[model samples]
Target: MKKKLGLTSKIFIGILLGAILGLILKGMPDSTFKNTILLNGILKVMGSGFITAIKMLVVPLVFVSLVCGSSSMGDVKKLGRIGIKTLCFYLITTAVAITLALGIGKLINPGIGLDMSSLITQKPTIGESKSLVDIVLGMIPANPIQSLASGEMLQIIVFSLLLGIAISMVGKKAEPIKNLFESANEICMKMVSIIMLLAPYGVFALITNTFATTGFDAIFSLLKYMFAVSLTLVLQAFVVYASMVKLSTGLKLKPFFKKFASVAAVTFSTASSNAALPLTIESMEEIGVDNSVASFTLPLGATINMDGTAIMQGVACIFISQLYGIDLGINALLTIILTATLASVGTAGVPGVGMITLSMVLTSVGLPLEGIGLIMGVDRLLDMARTTVNVMGDCACTLVVSNSEGEFNKDMYYGKDCNNLNKLSESELNKDMHQDEDCNNLNELVD
Candidate 1:
């Protein structure tokens, strides 16, 4: 008998089928479809459950993996160089993103020549902004258990890194705990794979539910805004990242993009930079980045990098201003960039944080926060694309930094063997070790 379709393929089919069904049902009268309780309930349950499972793994995965990666480094100071480079790249790229968004939004004026009476308002619960001292102190985690319980991923990451580094410093004395963490890391990866098995069902539900409720009208209404946002995102991905690749590593742009395209698509579809972290690291390694650098920088970038978010804020600020007929001055534009960049750091890794941060940006520029509702209807659809861009930015930074530090494989980067290079680096590491062991055994026999 022919083999059944795999999980991913199955999910893809489901998604396509769901889209068609949803569109069909959307055109039907309410009384005709309102009684289909079973279908609706199943979709809701499966879709929400899948998202929950994905979210459930995010915190532990980030904490355990960061600890495992950081602790294995064997030196804390080396992280400083990586940290500096990573932060500098993230911040600079974010500024550029916002600038691009702002410039483009102004030119396109997507919100202009449109009425606003129909837009719905969505008020987000705003968190208190802590002082720099408090933020830094919070990083130390007064109680790690509490941090984990609260799902404070950044705090958990910080605590894990510190604990991991301390373990490394303790040397052989900390072997048991170190080994335990290593085992935990492996288990988490297994969990990730298991969860991924449900991806197709989850994605189908997500996309179907979205399209079923949201007809193509919203897209039509926001076409200009979406177009502007997408154009800037693509330009930044190609122009900014490609330029950095050439400047830092002397690598050819075509091959670099070809290697990164698939991973970029995954990120764009998922929208969670953290979710895309594994793929990003794998791709970097396949392209010849050292494990040490890729492992450390990529995770950190997933947490703090906001080039895409920055761009959204920039465009949104301008878009909102045009809607309200307010002209943003030089100072106001500068303020939007500053606030958006900072807000990106503190924003939690959850759905709708982008809108929250965008609200913050609007407030900084004296734009009406209520104007946020104008775009909220279409925000979810745009988020996936922006997120994909965000993940791409993170990976690009990692590649550039790795290249600069001489940690990238120049041959793999320049070669046409991109297909074979797609294997996860961890597997390659295991193969090398097995070969080394065989060689050592032969040498011992000779002696």
Candidate 2:
């Protein structure tokens, strides 16, 4: 029998091949085969199909997993603590990310050598951002079905937690529904596993298409800026996040990185934290994070967390300021941190959303909005880098919160006797079932 390749190895190979093929196609003369059939046709279809498949798992998985996490909490106060801790961790890390980026950008001075005379500047018409009142009101979905239909994650999360809390409060009466949701949650996670099997090919297509279509001229022209952004993202992911996970959970960094390798590749290729959420949650479970922490924190982190985006904004702010020869005062620097950090919450987890939020940060710091044009050309590659950090931030927060709650499974996380953890989960299920006879039997639950 042929040896089976691990998911991490397969993904790495895919990324390598994709980059090679993309460079070849990009250098070749324009031809129908390369343009229509290869780049625009097959690669496009495969890449989009992969994204759609991942998204297909998001709503059901998030709703069911979050419901399970909330109901399993057994106490509303515990759930609140989870929420508070998760948010605080995400925000603080985002601030840290931007602060780090600014320091690096200043030291590197990415905008110093670039000639700006020929750069085309535009006045972007940024859409009005949501106010505190609007955000709070939007959290309480007036119509949850509409929210689900629209794939509104915040509202879905809110409604699911409320329903889960009510089920917990009902005591024995909610056992049937709780059991049903647990079964559904298991089934959804299985579906996520199924979707992940397509990741290698999906990542290949996405990366190939990106490099093929995006020219390297912008990248070469702004090499300094690109280097600064890439370096900051790498440091944040490996150095900052790795240290946090180690300090908080006492888990070895090597094993954690090995487990999360595939997740990082997916995030880099797809450039969307929301797209990576399902895989992040599954990987968190594989590495010993409790379902309650993984499900709740990952989804919520994807929705509001923008550590990577904050890094981009931070570096971009400083770069543009240097480009325009503007001396930023202490107050101006503080404004950038505050604006970028808060703007991350309102920003969605999609491509170019960071650039949009960066505009707001620029306005906050009295920088010229046109300065955004200086970095726009190199944003795609940076977007890929930052998205990976965003997902990593989510995983790091999940591990920390789980450790604090005493729900973390060290043995499973460390790759020692994996079946033992499965056995423990099975035992927990049995205990829950015994407590409520009306609950569905374990055998009746579908794999």
Candidate 3:
């Protein structure tokens, strides 16, 4: 008998093979077979289908899991505390990412002595950043169903939080409803598992499509910008997030990254946090973070937490400023930090949103709006790395909050007795439940 390959191994393999295939396609001459059959026909269909499959689960999973996590507490005040901690961690880390990007941009000088004639020929359409007032009011949805239909994540989170609190306030009267939400949450997770079965194929197709059209010419020209952005993202994930997990939860970092590898690959391929939400939550359970915290924080984090995007914007802003020989003052850098932080939270979690928010950051410091075109050529490649960091930020916050609230399962984190939980007798489970309030995860353990 042969041992089975895990999902993580398969996904990475897909990425590797996909990149090779994509490069081969890029090298080939332009032909109907390449464009009509290969690029648009198979790869596009499979990749888009898989993304649609995963995104289909995000709304239901967030709504159900959030309600389950929120109502499980039975205390609105605990929910409030979790909210504060989650937001603070998200916002603070985002600011740190921005500052780091600025430092990195200066060190690398990605745009010093660059030619902007070809790139900045036409002004890119700059999307307007929403005012803080508008973003605040928008969370209160006039029609939550419309928001869900449109996949408005922040709106969905607000509605879910309200529904959860109402469910908790009713107490015994809401028990049946709470049970229904819990069951629904389980079913949604099962759906996620089902969709993830096709992840490797989907990931392969997605990567293939990207590299097939992305020729090496643009890459050669903007390689420095690409290197700078990539370095910033790497630091954000390994240095900042590693320190955060160690400091916050006192957990070893190896197991955390190892468990999260497959999700990171998928997130890198998909490049949308909402599209990756299903896998992110599933991975959180494997990392020993409770569904309560994972459920609440991950969904909200996907919406407002844009640490990864902030890094991209910061680096791009600096790169652009240098392209036009604009010297940024210390006050301008401070403005970039504050503006990018707010813009990140206000921006949606869709793919390419970083570009939209980067416009805001650039405008704050009087840089050319058209400077965005300078880096657009390689944004697709860099986008994958940054999205992975955003997903990590979400998970890190979940771990820290879960550990602080005593909702985390250390035994699960250490890979001890994970399978044995299912073997325990009812009395054994009851005994453990008394010792740790987080045994609900044990009750729901599949293995």
Candidate 4:
């Protein structure tokens, strides 16, 4: 009999095998394999189905988890503190990321002297822009049931938070409501497990489709832009995040990076901070951060913390400006930073969000939104790097917040088994062993 591997181990194997298969398919002749039914029908359909299932779970998972997390605090004041801390951290980091990206993009001049006419263009569709009054009013859902049905995530989140808080206030009377939600949350997690089972197949297809069409040529053409964006992600991960961790928790940078590398790899491949949330939270807990802090910070960070997106906005703004031969004044620079930060909040956690947000940023500075076409082909490749930075920023913030709250465990942060040590202590191990003996004795008695 073979021993069963854990979820993480299985995922790792899936990723490795998928990469090998993708590479093999990549080398085959277009006539031989491009028209193959296996690639077009089986692999593509299975992969897309898996990704869709995961995405379907996002709004519900976030709303329930966040509401439960917030309301469980039992004190409304603590909710305010968490919100303030999270928002401040997000805004500050975002400002810094854009600044760094702007500096690098200007220095590299990736879009300078490039012809804008050569870029591809698609027909533009007008998007509905809400007024401040409407946006605020919309947050208060007229019908929570309708919001969920319509997949209105923000409205669902607002309703869930209000409901959770109301339940907390009702005290003992709210027990039924709390229990119901708790049960619902557990069911949702089970759903997540089912969705994750198909992840390897999904990831393999997504990557294979991406690379098969574009190959390395797309990356090569946008080499300078990609390099500049990539450099920001690397610096943010190693320099910014490492320094923050060292200062906050007094942990050595080397070990922190070692533990973080694997999680970062997943984030890079997925190109989604939210998709990487579970792994990021688990990794942080393993590194000695308290559950309370990890539970609070990581999810919120995944939703709103976007250092990588900020960096992209900065670079994109500069790239657009250079393409149009416009020198960005100090005022324009400040406006870009402010708009980018705000846009990050409004953008949904979906593919092409960066480009949409970048388009918004460009529009703020009087640059043509059509300039987005210049980078669309290479956007998928760049997304991986940006997402890794985004996930790293979230973890870094969790550490900082945890350290400040005095909730971080320094010994565990540097120790191995950071993930399971809390649940499987020496005392628990002994208890389990005794329980096994008792069960055996009872079985013998029955015999």
Number of the top TM-score candidate: 3
Tell me how far candidate 2 lies from the true structure as C-alpha RMSD in angstroms: 13.5
User: Tens digit of lDDT per residue, candidate 3, span 106-220?
Assistant: 9988777554434232443222355546655765789999988875555666687678778888899999999998888767666766776786787778667655655443235
Model 2: clashing residue pairs? none
Candidate closest to the true structure, highest lDDT: 3
Q: Which residue pairs come into collision in candidate 1?
A: none
How high a TM-score does candidate 4 get? 0.57
TM-score for candidate 1, residues paired by index: 0.57
Off by over 4 Å in 2: 1-78, 115-221, 420-447
Cα misplacement distance, residue 292 of candidate 3 (Å): 1.3
Q: Rank the candidate models, highest lDDT first.
A: 3, 2, 1, 4
TM-score of each: 0.57, 0.58, 0.59, 0.57
Clashing pairs in 3: none
Minimal lDDT window, size 10, model 4: 118-127
Task: Tally clashing residue pairs in candidate 2.
Answer: 0
Q: Each model's number of backbone clashes?
A: 0, 0, 0, 3
Model 4 agreement with the true structure over 305-373: per-residue lDDT tens digits = 778988988988787666555677766676677666644542345564465456556645566554454
